[model samples]
Target: MLRLPGFRVASPTTIAEAVAALAEPGARPIAGGTDLLPNLKHRLGAPTVLVQLSRLPLRDVEVRAGALCIGAGAVLADLAEHPLVRAHAPSLARAAGLVAGPTLRNLGTLGGNLHLDTRCRYVNQTPLWREALGGCLKSHGDRCHVVPGGQTCVAALSSDCAPALVALDATLTLHGPAGARTVALADYYCADGTAHTGRAAGELATEIRVPLAPGPRRETYVKWTVRKSIDFPLISIAMRFDLADDAVAAPIVAARVVVGALASTPKLVRKLDALRGQRLDDPATADAIAAQVGAQCKPLPNLPYDADYRRAVLPVHVRRGIAALVAAGENHG
Candidate 1:
């Protein structure tokens, strides 16, 4: 049986107490424990203490400053069904509903999902499995087996809420001993898989605010996984488009396309400077954009599915996302 290593759980009623607890050495913050517990059982991260976040008052979902402010501890199910989220950012709702299973969704918090760890085939294994192979770059090895002397870990992060939130122009507020600071959600990511989200050692996210886009905006979130439910996505796409008109071939006034689960950091495609204002309804245009998108992603053999298969599916996902958004926008108009 897989057993969690010896650890203590500290429940704090206030955010300051929780932050102080996490500041201790060998201490980690856990909200839903859906992802952290599994890793603990596998001996991947052996922190001596877990600072519980449920007792803190970080579970509210409300509107503030013309944006939907979501506490980090808010459960996925509630967030998915929140009236403000559904009305202002349906893509976030769609992504939240699609997370794992109904049970996990009820238990997992938005903060937990946003800060989920990166996964690699070599690292996410039993101790025995890792011992037999001398592990890999993310675990105990000197070289990355996937890249053969690659300098950095190539784990893939498959968080569903991250991409959708990024597409929505979200901002995250992190609290620690120093105080609280709000930054763009996009700024929370780093290039390294090992340090996927840029939450510092002593800091934890307290809340997120997603600004409402102007009218005539459409968004979509799509997840490609082996199973329909209770499975991590092999790849996921979250997209947003502001349309100039409801007519076919209408130009995109502004756009953001974020691809997740394919790399360490959810990748933001910003090469669309020339492509913006281009008609999104054109199949050929989408294909060309998809082709360009596919060229930028560098998939590695870190996921359960084959790397080549994941690589080949990028364009299909992009095409599908574009088609879905276009249709939805037209209907909205």
Candidate 2:
């Protein structure tokens, strides 16, 4: 049986009180406790204090001033089923629905998913197993076994929400003892896997603000994993496109093709510039554009799948996304 390391747990009713608790040395703020509890059970993390954010008023989802404001404590199921999310950001809604199982989705908060810990097969083992192997960089050792001679950790970022948020150009507000500040969703993640978050240690995510699209834009999220449900994605893609006319054109305006589960952070493939002004109905054009997209992705070998498999499937996902966007555009027209 895995035992959680000893710690003091505090549940605060207000955000201010929670922030104050987190400001204490060796204290960590937990929302949903999905990620932190597992880590604690495996002895991968040992904090002197665990500050729970469940009582904080951070569970609302509403539209305000042309933007969707989702509180950090909002459950994944709530975000997945929210009418605003379905209408405004269907990609995010789809992604949220595809995360874990119904039970987990009901308990896991959006903030917890956003701040999910980086993972690796070698790192997510029992303490005894890790200790027996002399440990990995993300665990107790100084050297990374995954990269051999590499000094930095190479754990894969397995969150399903990151790519969807990045594709939507969402903004996040973080609160702490020093007050609060907002940042672009892209800035939330660091390139390094071991230290993925750029937020201050004592800070907590307050809300996620996603701007409503002008006109009618279409979005979709597709995840390729070994299992249909209750498993992490092997390669997940979220594509958001602002359609113009029957075909995409200039000021086709904004598009984001984000690839997740293949790296330390969800990668943005900006080469999507090739698809601009291209008609999605033309299979030749779509195939050519997808080829270009596949060329830009560089998948590393990790997790349960091979790098080649992930790379090969990249174009297929892009092609399907374009098809969905075109279908949505036609329906709207």
Candidate 3:
């Protein structure tokens, strides 16, 4: 049986107290434990202390200063069904709803999802299994099993909410010894799989702020997995379209497409500004955007799925996602 290493737990009632506790050496902040517990059991990390943040008052979801402010402690199930989240950021709500299963969604938090650890097929296994395979880059070995002599770990970022959040142009609020500072969700992640997030050591993410769209907006989050439940995305995609009006034929003022489960950092498809002024229902619009997404996203052999198969279906899924958004109606957000 897999067992968690021995550790002391500290439950902090205030954010400042929690930050201070997390600042100590060998300290880790734990929210839901949905992701962290499993890794702990597998001996992936063994922090000397676990600082609990459940007592802190950070689980509110409301509109503050024209932006949807979601406490990092907000439960996934709550956010999935929250009216404010649905109306302001539909894609985020959908992504949250689709994470793992109902039981996990009930336990996991928005912050936990955002701070999810990157996963690689070789790295996520038991320590004994990894030892037998001579340990991959993420497991403390010299070379990367996925890239063969590649110095960087290419473990895939499996967070379902990250792509959607990025597409919505969200920002994160983190508090540490230095005090509070805000970072763009788009810039939060790095390419290194071992440590994908740019979150500083001893920092505690307190909140996520999603700016309200100035005009009508339509957004969707789609992913393909081996199982309907409990499986990470194989080809995750999130698309957001800003429209001039809430009409099916409304011209798109701007658009953002983000692809996840491809690398440690989500891939933001570029050259999408050319998609401006096109109707969401226009076939040419989906075609052009889909083409760009496929061209830019190159799936690696980091996950269990075949890299070529995931690459082949990326554009197909992108096109289908756009079509589904149009079918769902206008101004989904």
Candidate 4:
């Protein structure tokens, strides 16, 4: 049986205290403990102290001028069902509801999902199993098993909500010993698997702010995993575009296409100018856009799905997300 390392729990009552406690050596902040607890059991993470943020009043959901502010500690289940989220950011709600099962969603938080760790076939194993393989690049022992001769770890980031948030043009608030600084959600993750998030040590993500701007915004998230219920995303896609009206191609004021679960960070597809002012009136153009977005995804053999299958599903998921957005445009947009 896998056993978790002994660790002390540091319960902090405020955001200030939470960041202060996280400044200690071997300390890690845990909210849901859904992902962290399992990592602890596998001995993948062994922090000496767990600085719990449960007591903090960071679960408030507010609607400000042209933006929605969601506290970090807000539960995934609540976020999924919240009226405001369902209205303003249905894609975000869908992404949250799709993470794991109902029980996990009840415990999971938006912050935890944003800061979810990178996962690999070789690294996310029991201690004995990992030791048997001489450890992978993420464990800092040797080369990456996923991509031989690779200079860096290629562990796949399995965060289902990250892509949705990034596509929504969200901003994150992080508090640490150096005080608070806001970062764009797209800029929060690094490509390196070993230290995926660019967040500094002792930092605690406080909230997520999504702008309700450009008017008539349309967004949708779609994911395909090995299992329909609780499994992490194998190929998750979220597409956001601002349309002039419910028309298919209506002038796109802003657009973002993101692919997750295939790389250390959700990839924001470049060369998206083709989507601007171009209506989806022609199927060939839509297919071309999907192909262009899929071309940016870099899938590795780090997850359960075969690399080829993973790659093949990205465009399909993107197409589905766009279709969903088109269908829901009249209602929200």
Top candidate (lDDT): 3
Question: What does candidate 4's lDDT look like per residue over 127-196, in tens digits?
Answer: 8888888887788487878888888887888988899999998999999888899999989889799899
Instruction: Please say which candidate is ahead in TM-score: 2 or 4.
Output: 4
Model 2 residue 6 lDDT?
A: 92
Q: Pick the candidate with the highest TM-score.
A: 3
Q: For each candidate, what TM-score against the reference? A: 0.95, 0.93, 0.98, 0.95
* Model 3 per-residue lDDT tens digits across residues 1-333: 778999999999999899889888999999999999999999999899999877889999999998999999999999999999999999999999999999999989999999999999998999989999998788968889888879999999999999999999999999989999999999999989999998888999999999999988889999899899888899899999989998867999999999999989988999998887989899999999989998999999999989999999999999999999999885465
Which segments of candidate 4 are over 4 A away from where they belong? Answer: none
Per-residue lDDT of model 1, residues 111-164, tens digit only: 999998988888788888988998777787777877788998878888999999
Decide which is better by lDDT, 1 or 2: 1
Per-model root-mean-square deviation over C-alphas = 1.7, 2.3, 1.0, 1.6
Q: lDDT of all predictions, in order shown? A: 0.85, 0.81, 0.93, 0.84
Error of 2 at 153 (Å): 1.7
Model 1 residue-pair collision total: 0
Full ranking by TM-score: 3, 4, 1, 2
Give residue 163's lDDT in candidate 3 (0 to 100): 97
Off by over 4 Å in 3: 331-333
* Model 4 Cα RMSD, 1 decimal: 1.6
Model 1 lDDT on a 0 to 1 scale: 0.85
